[model samples]
Target: MRVADVGEFGLIERVTSRLTYGPATLLGPGDDAAVIAAPDARVAASTDVLVEGRHFRRDWGSARDIGHRAAAANLADIAAMGGTPTALLVALCMPPELEQSWAEELADGLAAEAATVGASVVGGDMSSSPTLTIAVTALGDLGGRPPVTRSGARPGDVLALAGRTGYAAAGLTVLSRGFRTPRLLVEAYRRPEVPYAAGPQAAGLGATSMIDVSDGLVADLGHVARASGVAIDVRRDAFEVPPQMRDAAQALGADPYAWMLGGGEDHALAATFPPGVDLPPPWRPIGLVAAGSGVTVDGKPYTGSAGWDHFR
Candidate 1:
């Protein structure tokens, strides 16, 4: 039967029946809001959207890859909040002619990503539109700790990062060139496995300020800088980014430096810490917070044209 026959609510009801609610779920999928049991007293939440053509190409990525990308994007937001991803809410809009198998594969990909992040798809909605759009909202529980917001960095705080950057930019370049996707970049573009564990670890280990690197390194930290009322400086050569980036970038006549500094969608973690905060093992030091407001990279302002913002 067609979706027109079942309708929106009917479809939701149909899909909702397949889920198994656990005891941790204070409230499941029926009301205007889902009441979660974060009695620990802090909730970390984030949302993001992916649009057809802008975020992905149907010609290049499978429906499953699309779903994985969308889910990873949302989960990364949660990780940036320094919270454990407890659950997710997804909303999908697409053209009428999109195939049923496509949706199912997309669902599989979404499920796989959420599971990897230790989150479940608690609830979501489906609708029909002229073009494909995905909106995902991720919720996490801080388990009684105060959230590490973009503010709160002190002048002496060391800037640190967890997870890879610039790989997605490289991946996009590969996709654009009709190359048979580089493994690392394609993996990055398909599903950026945000370092979920680092968020809570950073929070527990005494992080001062935090944000996910959705926008470029400089741009995301700029949010922290403006929020914390401090200047931030990033040492570009600090992190060993993917080498495939150089080759892919040169192939496209793109600057790997620009890609490293400005290309986003990496969903890497960036946070500040007081001197000797006993940071998590794998996290790397990349910059520092200073007594001013703004961001400097390797001691200079990054003048690239591509940090994230709609219609920019």
Candidate 2:
């Protein structure tokens, strides 16, 4: 049925009925809270919210994109803590005019993406709203290891990152400039592909502190700096934005540096490690851990937008 032709609950019924749950599920769906097990590991939890206009644009993305993104965002946060995602509890709010089919498709997308990280959606809540909103709470297990948080980088540690940056911001620039959304850029904007393996990799390699670069490389690393009580430095000349990004920036007449330095939501893994710890390939070393209390790019103070804020 068309999106405008169906109401919400009807769509939810269709989606939930189709899932193939795993053996790990103690309780699945139809519950106020789903029970899960992490008998041998510590449970790590994280939550995130996406508002209609602030977080997504329906005109630029499908219902599937929204579901995938909302789930991915929460899961990445859990991963940043050096945990493996176990399950998710989703809450959704939608306007009365929304099609039930849209919600069903969204659920399908969420379920599929969660499965990619070995996670399942065991329960959820729904309500009517003036516009679409999504809240996802993700739970993970630390596998007998302590959480790798945002406060451990020490002097002389190596600063590195796994995964690409600037693609989403460049995508946004293309959309705002009245150009057709490039398929890659549109996908980047819709569902940021997080390096789910990087978090555990960092933990295994004895990373001192780690954080996901959701809010640009420089800005998010600053979060690590402030939290760890150390200074971080990033080398701009060593930075590389993908070719597609350079082309997109040219098309939009914008500086790719701004996006690379300040763009958010790419969900890359950034961490600091002591000497001789072998960082896996593509977790490119960007700079060194310094002896101060903030992050600097190219050995100097970076003067630009740090990242997003609730009130700008």
Candidate 3:
């Protein structure tokens, strides 16, 4: 059945009933607002919107895949701030012709991803629209630690990355070209992986600055470089394209390095720690912060397009 058959409130109930809240929730859905625990006495919040034919394509992914991608994107934002996600408020806008089962599957994907970080969907709003849009607001706890913002990096800091990159962008190319690669690469494009634990770990280890690689490595790092007023030099030799992406690149005759440098939506954490500080697992130094400005690939300015821009 379509969403129009059940109406607004019924659809809300169906989605909310499927989600399970944790101890962090004081009050969940079926309420005016959710009351969640704020042990740090401060909250880190980030919101992201996924629009059909823009952020995702229905034909390219399932409702569950879209839902998980949406959740991962927002959760990574909280992680970028050095906070542990506590809850999410998902606002779904769909056309009346949208199927009810699709909404249910989307909720399942959201809850599944939230459960990984011990978070849940507290509440949200549903409305009819001419197209599909999902807006997710994530709430996180800093655990009494100061947030790790993009502006905190200093000269002489070591740039490290936690989690893989470029796989999603390669996957997108594979899909666009109608080429087939490994299942993982395609799935990476559909539901990018977000290293949830690495966020708080970086904060605990005193990360000077951190940001998620949502809009390609160089583009996102450009934000850090611009914000911190420092130059970031990424080592070209330090990158090793995943074997699957390498094969896909070969098939498409695409530059794997471009995928690594220009790919986005991987949601990997890129952080800077003080020089000589030892990085933990999944965190490896890829570059260094230095005086000056802008981002450089192997000590040279990157001239390619800087990741995704909503307009233009």
TM-score, every prediction: 0.91, 0.94, 0.98
Best by lDDT: 3
Model 3: worst 10 consecutive residues (lDDT sum): 175-184
**How would you encode candidate 3's per-residue C-alpha lDDT over 235-267 as one tens digit per residue?**
988899777878878878889898888889989
Residue lDDT tens for model 2, 169-280: 8777777676656778768877888898888878888989998887788889989999888999899876776778878878777788889888988888899999777877
The better-scoring model by lDDT among 1 and 2 is 2
> Candidate 2 has which clashing residue pairs, if any?
3-99
Question: What clash count does candidate 3 reach?
Answer: 2
Predictions in order: lDDT:
0.78, 0.82, 0.91
Best by TM-score: 3
* Candidate 1: tens digits of C-alpha lDDT, residues 79-104: 77677777778898867676655666
Q: Between 1 and 2, whose TM-score is larger?
A: 2
Kindly report which residue stretches of model 3 are placed more than 4 angstroms away from their true locations once superposed.
Answer: none
